[model samples]
Target chain A: MPACPKCQGLIQETDAFCGHCGNPLAATDPDRREDVFDVLTPTLAYYFITLLLLGIYKLTSVFPEGFEGIIVITAIDVAIVIAFWGNYFQSLRPLFSLRGLSLKVMAFTIVGAMVGSVVVSVVAKWINLSIQDDVFYSTYMFQDTAYPFLFSTLFIAVQPAIFEEVAFRGFLFDNLLKVTPGKSTVYVTGFVFAIIHLNIISLLWLVPLGLALGFLRGRYNTLWYGMVAHFTYNFSLTVFEFLSWF
Target chain B: METSSVDSSAETLACENCQAVNSATQKFCSQCSFPIGGTKNEQIAFRSNIAVRTRMLKESERHVSICKKLLYFLAGINLLLGLYFGFAADDFPSMISSICVALLFLILTAWADRNPFGAILTAFIVYLTLNVVNIIDNPALLSRGIPSKIICTVLFVGGIRSARQVTLQREALEKLKAPGIGNR
Candidate 1:
């Protein structure tokens, strides 16, 4: 006896509809999803809300100018994520688990991220001869009366390390796993991560870094590994920026 | 060509329309679902359902094509606007900025041509983000290009609706393409 593809109710070989479910024997495909959007509707919706809010703030001039602005915006981001996070909590919960955490691989991830950050920055600067990144840093990053470096570490490194890993590695990567092969999942999520940052110049290095982060999450089955790696990478760059490497 | 006079008592049956064979217990033909073993009324109902679905697929495809043109128009407008600004203001960076944006739209347009549902949504998100950056960077900029901006936003919203239509149509078509699942 075969089964209905959609309802899974057993049916006789010659039956057009399942005996129990009466569903037409048509629609026998197991999974109907064909495109990236097919699998990523929910995840994209969550991402869209955040981006839309940011745009709304800019257009309205309601967003503040400095640290207060950053805090408020970050707060809204967190709230938006939390709102969406409730629905996906069950699906995303596994990413937070710490099973199979190997000390050796963790150590390598941290070291590799640190070393890779230097190469990325240097190569990025080389690729664009006049990499006027100072404008970007001055415009968006830790501005203020004092403790700019500390704020830089917090905002630039720690925040993205923890939060971004949750979004891209946690939500987006996991969503891709169902539709794509394992390695493709890493590559696709990496590409998406880089593009979302909206910096065309930074895409050269950001893409690889996104791939690295995706690899860590998928391999370890936990976001902790990726978070630590992301923090190390971003923190090293933060330190380098203060040291005037650019 | 439909031969719905399938014999219920026979061990094997052949489809009335396509002539594909099926088991007597099967109410629909295996290859074409021609109601090889069903009564006259059942066969009519099955075909009516299929006809309705086929009509929907055709409608959705038409809608997707219209939305795709909107994306192409957006790309051309961005290229023209960016070049105008770059030349008028004599700022290379500003010029590069719009050119890059134009390129992104062109790429997105191509992607939409292939996969309208997912690709168009991606474009819609990026389009909004760019405008947000523009408004934040210079509030005056929004006031400067009111008509074009409004038109672009309308196109994006329309494109998104068309993408939803594509999503629904593709799902229905997939069922027919699946093995052992002839037209519903």
Candidate 2:
């Protein structure tokens, strides 16, 4: 009749190991209410590495000029995308389903991304103005090119759209479902997504952008909508980023 | 990190939580670290203890990260100021050194996640060394940014404290892994 204190699995006095969980049965300590952290380690490690890489990328300015720099940056993003699908191939395969995806959802999500980007742009401008820092925007490889819009959209909008969705909505959000209940999972994923961007100044818009992407992925149960939204958002900002140079 | 689904079978092992099913050859769930076949309460308790330690380590990580962000901002400012002054005199040494220092801070910020205490301690030493060198060059240098300098010093000191906590938490977690841990 005595229960194992550890996992609450039933154990007979004669059995040394718990039949349910296989834990060794022990006497003495009363069962205390237990809590759970509710995450698998690999996912946590991925997020941690992502933050470190993004932070280092932000602070270090030693990349070769122009398009070469874009190649270097995008290489890391591509590798991360590979890792996301490689490590969790079976788990992430489900997010690729088009069950709830529709033209209306894609259109709505794209509109949301555009509106979100504008809000972010305005908030970013306000922050720059208020801080009086002039907020150096590094054009990097996107500068002085014959095809600034092409390079920016390819390197910035398209690449990040695919990569970020896979990393966050596909890998992280799916994994988070194992830990958290349905309601808060999206926002939690969004919060983590925002933090990884490493731009405190744009957090006002970044958080919203993150939430919108999370919502798209969560609502429709597909990465395509989120990808469309993400691409739209970044592409819109790419326009804004290049607007002043001309 | 690899997770594969297994159809329910007599030969397969199951995890209590996380829903991870493992082959009979596996002793723990690869995805969740849950023990397989048979587990002891002590193992669960041990993982729980480790989870707590991991949380503590993350809080410390947040501290060093803030310190890292502060370094980022200061390094940018230093690089800009160095270029400005160096350009006025056409002296490239200060500019080169400033860039080197900025790069060093960036590397330290990346390393901070892995070893918060060591990275922050090294960063603190470098920061203090820079301030001392500047003060020696011109005693009046201290007067210009006293408030800002004080804030940086306080934040660095707090970062160091958090790094120490990280070390302690890590050690405790390591001890929990020693042989006879779950046996006890």
Candidate 3:
């Protein structure tokens, strides 16, 4: 039976479209879109409590000065990654039973990252004239940094590719498909993905990325495809940053 | 269209308003939005979806709450450790760094409460800003680039995971309260 992408409502197998929501029922693979509220709330709550405590400490003269900010940021990043590792592996268990699919999905994620990054960079330059940022095409952040090559590669190439795909493609995309009424689910999820970046300049870059990723996931019916594409896009950025071409 | 009357017994099942023939097992009028007599099949289907979605959300929420508490505790410990190291080793930067680290984490947790995605983005921005500041200001830390890189890598990996976990739990919870599942 064909299913509605939005609400996961089943339709007749031979139906041209979903009767419940009127979405075209040509495809068999279901879309999965993650919910932002589900992903952000508890962490935000804890972060808030911690911030309050830090505020008091600063007021009382216990606040660390100079390089201490780096330490705190580093630790928070560590905590978040640990959580990602746990979830990523847990989610992967089911796919372990299907080794080929798993490999394909992983490859797909990397490719997606590369493509996304190239697209972002190109669009960034094209619209550079449209935005007003003294730091728009700076060689400073990438050039002056002692290990621009390493950090950019690691941050851009490795981390974002994996986590973003897991969050957006693996989880958000799937859940979104279950809630929406029709094909509107795809657009809604894509829009949410774009907005998540929280940068007006990034809106243009992200929306297309969202649509492309959504389409790839739906086309392949595998999370790995999105992941590979995401990875590729990011890896390319890392390389570009390394070469200082940007 | 003609107002045609159906043989009630022959059709066996029919809509009250539209009088359209339906199956004995069908629970809804295809033409008009009406209850198909007294069968509870649709009700059971509706309830099951709600129950499943609800259960998933609640389960994820509990996990998220625990993770949040854990992060807070970790921040506290890091802060205390910084104080101890500051006095013992007389390395003010190390001490400050530890305390600042705790503070940043706290900020992230707080920001996350209001906006989860914002918390992650801010965390990244904060980290990058702090590192850049340190690289410019602290010659000693700058000279120790390898160690800094290692530290960055470790934290980056860990942060991404924790961020993912927080988000996963949130997503599950949202699904629980989503529309359509519980709607009549």
Top candidate, metric DockQ: 1
State each model's C-alpha RMSD to the native. Answer: 6.2, 14.3, 15.7
TM-score of chain A of each: 0.75, 0.75, 0.55
Q: Rate the local accuracy (lDDT) of all candidates.
A: 0.67, 0.63, 0.50
Residues A72-180 of candidate 3: C-alpha lDDT, one tens digit per residue: 5334544654564465566544422334466655665666566666666666778663221311122223444676566555554455556555555654455444433
Runs in model 2 deviating more than 4 A are A1-38, A129-140, B1-184
Each prediction's TM-score versus the true structure: 0.71, 0.48, 0.41
Model 1 TM-score relative to the real fold: 0.71
DockQ winner, 1 or 3: 1
Please provide, for model 2 over A19-72, each residue's C-alpha lDDT reduced to its tens digit, 9 standing for 90 to 100: 455454434111222122234356656765665454444455555545776677
Pick the lDDT winner. 1
Give one clash count per candidate, in the order shown: 1, 5, 69
The best-first sequence of candidates by DockQ reads: 1, 2, 3
What is the DockQ (computed on Cα atoms) for candidate 2? 0.04
Deviation in angstroms for A140 in model 1?
11
- Residue B77: error of model 3 in Å? 46
lDDT of 3 by residue, B1-184 (tens): 3122222453446655345454444444333323455347654553465566566555654544544554576578768989998988888867866786677569657755654333444454344434444444443665676775665545543454444444554443332323433221
